[model samples]
Target: MKDIRIGIIGFGTVGSGLAKTLYEQKDRLRQKTGANLTLARVADISITSLPKEYSDVVLSNDANDIFNDPEIDIVVELIGGMEPARTFMLTAIAKGKHVVTANKALLSIHGKEIFDAAVKNNVEVGYEASVGGGIPIIKALKEGLVANRINYIKGIMNGTANYILSQMTDRGLPFAEVLKKAQELGFAEADPTYDVEGIDTAHKLAILMTIAYGLDVRLDDINVEGISSIEPIDIEYARKFGYRIKLLAISRNHGDNIEARVHPTMVPENHMLASINGAFNGILINGDTVGDVLLYGAGAGMMPTGSAVAADVVDISRNILAGAINRVPALSYLPEHIGKPRITPMTDLVCPFYFRVTALDKPGVLSIITGIFGKHGISIRSMIQPGQDAGEPVHIVFRTHRAAEAAVKNAIKEIDALEICSAPTVKIRILNPE
Candidate 1:
């Protein structure tokens, strides 16, 4: 058995996990793959202290040690950023070593450049941990579903956002309260803009779309919306209508075009994804041959993500032993076959919408709102208006029939401008079970 030396940078959550797994399970991995996979070194700039178990392996405060070394055949970049991570991966690839990573944001933004460089250097990049933690969705899509054309993909990829939403729905708690609780519980970061604002989910979604279809999808191409605007009232209303609000990352194939967006979506109660709660993740994928497949697991944690990174190491090591470099292209497709996807504009999309409008109690207020919706080609399928005292502000919630995105925006703008309105309307897209 040939020895494949490994070097890891970033001793944070994921980096430490990878080191521990590779170190402790060295015998098991060698027996399984017949390759001596070695944890050659680990480098991190933020090591105040080190775990006693990891004391046997090497430790460095700088990343240059990994790049400068010649014996490291696989460079694992777990730093989770753009600048040095990108540069470090490129440097390792330039040295003709296989690269593995879990940095979704960096890969989503600079994937084209990195993959281009990998191709030029004749190396492979493993990113299975980038999307659904340890779910193995990337391998399933890349190899298992390679024969069929993908129809659509829906996933709850972010555990922090899911935890916040799950708390809000189950306990009827406000968004602010749950976010604070999540922060205390270590499920969320001090600065959670990435998780809460749908940016994190969008980054993962872009990577999935890129693999599912041989297209290079980016973060800016996705239409992202956050869970901050979701309120208790909206949650209650969705329950009454036999639905639940979830931050869903969705990508659909529309023949010549594709639909990619991330937002707080209204899912029917019976949908499989609606039942996925807490810091867990679930992905629903449909291929022409397989129909629908659901993958559910702990999206993020020490062992789960580390296990993913280790799996990539084994795969790359086996390939190295077999002399099969680039056996599977980094994005599961060659550069000649991968190109920019035709993303469908959000404005032209047609879907059901839930509107929460606040207006003064008056006879003509309903008429004015309905008139605007009608003029813009939007038809209301149902509405709920609880009794309100005369002249007081009343909340009228409407579930519209399938309407164009442009029509809904125009109608909401006109209705909010009305003199009798109390507050701006809140709109959320609804996805009925298909």
Candidate 2:
């Protein structure tokens, strides 16, 4: 069997996981792919964290050592971020070395440049582990669903945020408390802003949108809203309405325009996405020919994510054995075929909404709120006004029919400015997938 020399940069969680997979599954990979994979070198600042078995593998403090080595055929970059990883990958491509990475942020931001370099150098780039870990969603989109036109994609992409939200929903805990528990369980980073604020989900959505629609979408284009402001009362109200709240990354193609957003969404309790809890992930995709397909699995973890990276390695290995490069276009479409689709502004997008207003228990409060909704051309489908003690700020909740986001925002702003309203209105978009 032909031997494939591999080099890894970044010996962090994912990097160590990849090493473990390479060490334990080497024989199985050889049997499956007929390629003897060799872990030639690993580049990390501290080699102390790596297991002792990897001592035989070449270790270096600088990543340049791996890039400079001519024997290394595949460079797996697990060191996430926008800096040296981008430069290192470009250098590897320039040197005609294939790349496999799980860095979603780098790819979402600098994919076009990196893919261009790979094409220019006639090398393959595999990133199956970038999005849904161990779910094979990348391969499903690029290969399995190649024949169909993808209509839309919705997913619970961030495990950290999902875990927090799931805990809050299950235990009736608040966001802060659940977030602390998530951090204690290692589900969240010390600084969980990226995951909790929807940036990470947006990064993954950008990658998925590019592959699904062949659009040059960027993370900045996605409308992002986090679950930081989601209250236990809001969750309770959603449960009362037979729905569950999930942080969802959603994208829909409308031919001339596409909608991409990440936010806390209320989905029907029976929906497949609603059933997904804990740190697991589920993606629901719609296509012209396939109708709707759901892919569910462990979204992130050592073994699951490492298996995904190894799968990408095997894919590149097969391509190498066949003497083919750029076997599939990096974004699932030829560069020339990629068209710029206008991203529909969040203000113009139409969706049902859930509104919570805390207003002084005085006369005409409901009338004023309803009048503002009417002024904005918003139609309320249903409302709840639970009994409140005298002279207390009463909670009023309304579910609106399909309305433009701009109208809803304007109405909320006007209502919040009213004398009777105690706090800014809470708004959560309601998602009822067809």
Model 2 C-alpha lDDT versus the unseen true structure:
0.91
Every candidate's lDDT: 0.91, 0.91
lDDT, residue 200, model 2: 94
The regions of model 1 sitting more than 4 angstroms off are: none
Which residue segments of model 2 deviate by more than 4 Å? none
Inter-residue clash pairs, candidate 2: none
Ten contiguous residues with the weakest lDDT in model 2: 46-55
Model 1, 1-434: lDDT tens digits are: 68899998888889888888887898999898898888778888877556777665678887778888888899999988898899999999998888999999999999999999989998889999998898998899888888888999998999999999889999999999999999999999999999999999999999999988899999999999999989989999999888889999999987788999999999999999999999999999999999999999989999999999999999999888888988887788778999788999999889999999999998988988998999999999999998999899999999988999998998999999998998999999999456
